[model samples]
Target: MNKNKKVIEVKNLKKYFNVGPGLTLKAVDDLNFYIYEGETLGLVGESGCGKSTTGRTMIRLYDATAGEVLFEGKDVHKMSRAEHKDFTRHAQMIFQDPYASLNPRMTVGDIIGEGIDIHRIMGGKERMERIYNLLETVGLNREHASRFPHEFSGGQRQRIGIARALAIEPKFIVCDEPISALDVSIQAQVVNLLIELQRDMKLTYLFIAHDLSMVKHISDRVAVMYLGTMVELASSTELYDKPLHPYTQALLSAIPIPDPNIERSRQRVLLEGDVPSPINPSAGCRFKGRCRYAKDVCHQQMPELREVGPDHFVACHIV
Candidate 1:
């Protein structure tokens, strides 16, 4: 992917929900970022930090509360019915839970071919061949396509999910924690398959996960989120080596070092207090309540993401 060319642009994206009488929950609050074509942009944050919601909203699975998402220079939310169908065909998603994501009732072949049939891409023998090919592409066989999802193991089921995502031949995919539910041994296998598939397909990916280590391996760029706001965005190597935001530093510090000597010597940035509620976040920094270097201004006004270095962006008053 050319780092200069953006395939998807998310501008001031906000997604909220009315939980109850007069109460609102801000799931994703004013997020702004761009994903380059054929590149993996990692969205990392602690669980319930709006990572999944952002992916869903960007894909139009959930409507936006405000702001716009541009796909190849066209606003996704503003698309007409015909354009919306085209958008769906151009983009796909690999969900977190393979077991739950796959239909228990549908055969693997039918599940994978659902999109093909809906789009009327091919029918009968042609569609059957395509399903078989997709199964093989994801490391399964033609025979397994006739079986139900429950008959396969967790890893195999995820492969089926991958096959299903690829059935439509999408240019972009939102991988929402696709490997988090797999076994540690199986996680690497799935991630490797994704990387290989991306290279072969020239696919752009918005890979969302809380697992920093895995994200580093697959992503070209990484964005750190706190509560519902992005605190830092930079290349994977740069962000992991010299994290600018305090929240980012805290997150990277928690990744265990393989070397025992370095592990014991390195100081951990232990964050205090729980994550603040998104219902009504603090004024300035979303992480101010837990940040060690909080100042008066940090509570008075929110900080916008600013370019701190080449290809690096950070949203913090003190960064």
Candidate 2:
């Protein structure tokens, strides 16, 4: 554990949306987590679990309804305009869909150099040189930067997005499912590239992905969320070896084993009920409906994330 290397600290973070006149959507409900310098923290959950919202809100894409996001021991939301501008240079995001994220009308070079232009970091020739260098770093050539986004493959387009993020010389990046839209074979290539970049540039990442196998491979610590609430968090090996929460156990059970004998021997745990809606969620455990061990206490009181073991936390009545 890197005790002295805290880069981003999130405490009791909440992001609520007004769905209607009186109703509210609890996208990220009282979440608390942290990211260390030069480390990859993986946030994993099913669809609509608020993993993406948490990442976006931390970077101030959506104004957080409550809680503090501290970057380098300073409150990120409370920064001055000049400080915020500097923050933008140090922090960046890679969107889920590379095609939708990039501008269709702009050439790849322009898209990559947009941040440099906005920040006034370089002249015309210098900016073009940086763009070409960024493209090369992301496995794309300088010539490819002359074409529009439509001219590239999904993986190649994602490379362009990565180049754009790198153009600003960011120290931290929010990888919002950057490879979800790519081919399975290409997924590994992208992950490898990210790993290489981290090694070379000492970049820190908050890698949000629903793919458990891939998350385990890339993350230093793993956090599990359910219906806008975090249920479990721990080191990758610890989470996989001994998942404390009922939801975490069920999720791990569903991962298929390659060996025929092991696969046949392992029993699959299938939950009975569907995930409850985030909007106007019941005042209790959000995962109560699908938890086999859920009791009356689970329906009456929400579980706070508590330390179960060394660096392992879980939110469940049984835990």
Candidate 3:
């Protein structure tokens, strides 16, 4: 996994949106993590947990409200014009919705080659050849290059989005729920393709999604987020086998098992309360409101994410 080489490092990152008068939405708050070179770090959480926001802010798609995102030891938000351009070429994003992400007017070839042209990487026959190669690499053909996004199915459209991201030959990619919009049957296909591409291209990924099972399949490590705060982080196997935080435990318990007997015998950890709003949130653990083991301290102080076991971290007082 090349743990010694960090492809991306996020430190105390925050992204807040001012929604109305005297109101701010903390989309991503106090995030801290790192993506190793040539490894996938899966980010799993419920909707509106800031998983996408974290990915976006890390890549500088949205400017941070606080803290830094270091890309190969360089602060991403502090880069110069030329450096930002180079960063764009080195890092790319694959949006969640294939239908909305791709330009409807542009053909597959043009969409994939846009980055190449913008970066002036190549032109003429070589450019066309690269486009053709990318198309074939993503399981499309040269003939499909002339077709618009509407001509392809959902999965096929996503493959095109992948090709577009790959066209720049990026070292890191923010896969913002890239397979969420696809059919259940097709989701695995897309994830498998991503795994294959990462291995072949030597790419690192921050793969954000709500599907824990899929995340486990594709990720070396997984981080669990709740109310824009990280509750737990660990190796995929470790997190699934022995989750420490209450929120993480509840989240892992919800993943249905294939065996009927095991599923029937297992007890689900049902969270009682609704998730608290992130707008000017209280000074305490975000999950304490719903946590069964919440103590007096949990309501007063936000527990920092601490390493308890080998490569396993959790943010909870009871842990």
- Cα-based lDDT for every prediction: 0.94, 0.92, 0.94
- Each candidate: how many clashes? 0, 0, 0
> Each prediction's TM-score against the native?
0.98, 0.97, 0.99
User: Tens digit of lDDT per residue, candidate 1, span 208-301?
Assistant: 9999999999999999998889999999999999999999999999999999999999899999989877886657878889999989889988
Winner on TM-score (2 vs 3): 3
Using TM-score as the measure, what is the rank order of every candidate, best first? Answer: 3, 1, 2
Which residue pairs of candidate 2 clash? none
- Report the C-alpha displacement of residue 241, candidate 3, in angstroms: 0.4
Cα lDDT tens digits, model 3, 153-209, are 999999999999999999999999999999999998899999999999999999999
Residue 303, model 1: Cα distance from true site in angstroms: 0.6
- Candidate 3 deviant stretches above 4 angstroms: none
- Candidate 3 matches the true fold with a TM-score of 0.99
**Candidate 1 versus the native: TM-score?**
0.98
Q: Residue 235 of candidate 1: its Cα lDDT?
A: 96
